[model samples]
Target: MDTYAVHAEGLRKRYGGKDALAGFDLAVRRGTVQGLLGPNGAGKTTAVRILATLLRLDGGRATVAGLDVAKEPRAVRRRIGLAGQYAAVDQVLTGRQNLEMFGRLFHLDGRRARQRAAELLARFDLVDAADQGVEGYSGGMRRRLDLAASMILAPDVLFLDEPTTGLDPRGRGEVWDSVRALVADGTTVLLTTQYLDEADKLASQITVIDRGRAIADDTPDGLKSAVGGDRIEVVVGEAADIPRAWQVVAGVCREAPETDHGERRVHGLVHDRVAALTEAARRLRDEGVAVEDIGLRRPSLDDVFLRLTGHRTAEEKAGAAV
Candidate 1:
């Protein structure tokens, strides 16, 4: 049995003199969530379109579900499902009707379409509201319905392009749960998203792309560790206590702490997380420094992105616009 559901090597796509994908490569293990994390316009959607056969690659090779994408486009389409940034369901139709419509569009006969629709409605937890018009459904519900529509044929690999974009916390969580359930049932997922936390939470392995190329790829924990170790942060209650607090943290961490006077915060990296926090707290108490909050934390994905890409994802997005 093949270990990878999707594999790409030196994939390239050009848009009017600009390369949307420049030598991009990926390997997504079967039954696992592989995150393609990058800023806006980082060729994430372009890569997905290529693999889904919606767009052709200018160079390189790719295979989905063990079929060469270029040579066996039809076969690749059969084994894969794609849900883009927006929901593609009709608001005027009921959830069940929309799903059945998709089933029929996929060439299923009337009886099989209904059966598949019923099965999907139950699988996606839309049974209670299955009969209601989709216009009344919440954002999460609509996205879930979109997900169900993509699963009409129970694809082996599902490509979710920023699936939770523009969703509220609750709505994003709902979609996350749905994704979890899909992977649990042996579906491989290639999730492309700008949300760092979303990638951290859902992906087993992450490939960080920048300027249409991958710069780093690793597990969430491995990426974090690559950037640095834990950090001790202190927020002082009074602006006047900033210096004292910084000194205290610096002493505990054995390094100069970075201080933000405007925010009255001081933080520094540390090797021993618990010991640094303990000593910092004790020293702050002894020095009469009025501390608002103090804690130890590992490097976040935001920090890792900044370190690896030399800018946050938002910065990259803004730069891309100009």
Candidate 2:
């Protein structure tokens, strides 16, 4: 068996004067979820489009499910399922009809299409609502239906581009479950997501890109360590106490602390987790700084993004527009 489900080398694409993908390269192992992360306009969507055969690359060799995406577009399409950032199903169609329609589009016979739809409905837990018009479905249900439709032909590779973008927590959880179930059944997944928590929870490996270039790649814990080690964070009861709390945090950790006056929060890294947390708490008590919350925690993906890219994802999005 091929060890990789998707492979690309020095992929490049240019839009007028700007490069959308600059030397983009990636290898997704079979039967695992690989998270593709980056600030906006970092070539993630472009890479997906190229690999899915929706857009042709200017330069590079790429393959999906062992077929050259450029040379064998139809074969590649047959073996891949893509659920993009938004739900693509028609509102008038029932979930079952949507799946069946997708199956037929893939060239399945009428009976086979209905069978595939039934199977997907059960697998995605949409059997109860299978007959209901998608117009009546909640955001989560619509996403689930979109996911189900993608798998109607049980493609070998699945590309999910921010699959849970607008979902509430419950809806996100449902989509996550659907993704997990797909992976369990031996589908290789390449996921693009803005939600660090979702990627942390689902992705087996994460690759971060910036300015259309690959910047970092690692597992969730490994990526967190890139920003810093165990850090102490404390929330002061009053915004006026931010400086005092910062001083206390810096003194205890022997490192410069970051403060957010609005939240009255101060945080700094420490070589010693226990000593830092305990000492910080003791000093805050002695200084009469009322504490709202405190903890020694590892860096989150958000912190990693800011530290690596020199800006947050939201700021990156804004810059992309300008």
Global CA lDDT of candidate 1, please? Answer: 0.92
Model 1, position 284, has a per-residue lDDT of 95
* Ten-residue region with minimum lDDT total, candidate 1: 310-319
Give the Å error, residue 289, model 2.
4.0
Residue 130 local lDDT, model 2: 94
Candidate 1 lDDT over residue span 216-292, tens digit each: 98999999999888889999999999888978888877567898888899998997889889998999999999888
Residue 87 displacement in candidate 2 (angstroms): 1.5
- Top candidate by TM-score: 1
Candidate number with greatest lDDT: 1
Going through the candidates in order, what is the number of backbone clashes in each? 0, 0
Residue 237 displacement in candidate 1 (angstroms): 2.1
Q: State the lDDT of candidate 2 residue by residue for 29-136, as single tens digits.
A: 999999998887888999999999999999989999999999999999989999999999999989988999988998899999999999999999999999999999
lDDT against the true structure, each candidate: 0.92, 0.90
